[model samples]
Target: MLLSRLTGVSVLGLALLLGACSSTPEKEKVAEQPAAELYKESQIRMEDGNYRSAIAHLEALLSRYPFGPHADQAQLDLISAYYASADNPAALASIDRFIRLNPTHKDIDYALYMRGLVNEDEDRNYFQELFRIDRSDRDPHNIREAFGDYERLLREYPGSKYAPDAALRMTALKNRLARYEVQVAEYYYARDAFVASLGRGKYVLEYMPDTPEVERALELMALCYEELGMEKAQQDTLRVLKLNYPDNEMVLTVGS
Candidate 1:
């Protein structure tokens, strides 16, 4: 019985010594990893729409080897992840970081486009909320930032692979914003703010020629001028409307 206990103790001591000797180096086991592997895995997760898992690996890779060969790719994927996860602030930050670090990258146009995505077409829901809650309005800053990024992609990287997509999105966004302007003009018109209505209507006609509201905008301008009893302006707005829409019958007066 004593011999058996002695043998067991000897085996246990040897096993403990081996465990101590074979422990992985702290850095190698945890924080350090092959950059290419982590990046590839992150990309795979992103392509599969597993954005949260992708972000986990990307954040780890970036923390450890930020300047590695996959840094730029990881940074872009991080932005996508935040967007997918609906974390707008993080998405903005990631795109900003990518832009600042990779201004000269061949696909920098993509980064610019992404920044636009984070701020692009301002949804009416958010706008209405801001107007309701904030007397101090900072929402316009985000709109302008998004617009500027799209404009930058157009100007600096016109021939980029992403330029076509960016241009399409930019046009769509511009049209939506113009529609907002028309809404304001209609509001003023309804309130009998004749001068403001005329000015806003003219802007829609002159600046945004492609919107569906252009015809109605001219009609509003004519009404405003006639209400203010400006004969020449009334005639001119009617003339412009008839010229633009030759076949459509126009009502020149409120009751008619």
Candidate 2:
């Protein structure tokens, strides 16, 4: 009985081993494919929205033929695949590698744009989206990085096809950043930290002019000045606010 049981266990183990080996043959076949064939397969997979499979094929092609004619295009496609598959870190690393290696490549603008998109997306996750939580008051580090990426893309490639979209995104980022500053100032002011609140408000005015939040920043600064007993500064801030926004509620109330 013991011998029969051992034999049955050995048979099950052998079947498992065979199943593993069978799976590897397909991978080996993929690895042996020429660079062009792998690239074509990856393209097909990408077109089918199978980004995970596309990433595998693109990575294999790149690893096997780093100098092949398709290498550059494969690298760019790999970044897209990684991003589509929600592998943000991999996408960013691939984008940086492509930029560092191909600084003057014709598609450098696209890489920069993708970098900005990835960073911007990193600031929001599925939970935030599902809950419809406002992200403007969150930490702005990723938003700042994305803004810088878009700014660089526009500065370096003014004539790029991506320029218009980059410019629009930059404007939105500027507004969001200005709003973030205002929120921080509000937090400080609520705590009676008038000096810190004033500094934050000044940051929005000086560095983030023309944003919609500028009016709010000015109002907050004036209030902070009042709290700190800085009458002259409060008057100056209110004057500027009224000049820019004659119908502002604070201006009308203070005048009354």
Candidate number achieving the greatest TM-score relative to the actual structure: 2
Please name the candidate that would achieve the greatest lDDT relative to the true structure.
2
1-256 in candidate 2: lDDT tens per residue?
A: 0101112335567678558657533332356798879999999999998777888898889888999999999999998888886678998999999999999999999999999988887876554554568878999888999999999999999999989989999999999999999999999999999999999999998999989999999999999989888899899999999999999999999843
Q: In order, what lDDT does every prediction score?
A: 0.73, 0.86
What root-mean-square deviation over C-alphas does model 1 reach?
Answer: 17.1
Error of 2 at 223 (Å): 0.7
Can you give the TM-score per candidate against the true fold?
0.74, 0.87
Q: In model 1, which regions exceed 4 Å deviation?
A: 1-32, 121-145, 251-256
Residue pairs whose backbone atoms clash in candidate 2: none
Q: Write the per-residue lDDT of candidate 1 for residues 98-135, one digit (tens) a residue.
A: 77877788778878887887775233233234346532
The weakest ten consecutive residues by lDDT in model 1 span: 1-10
TM-score of 1: 0.74
Total clashes in model 2, counting residue pairs 3 or more apart in sequence or in different chains: 0
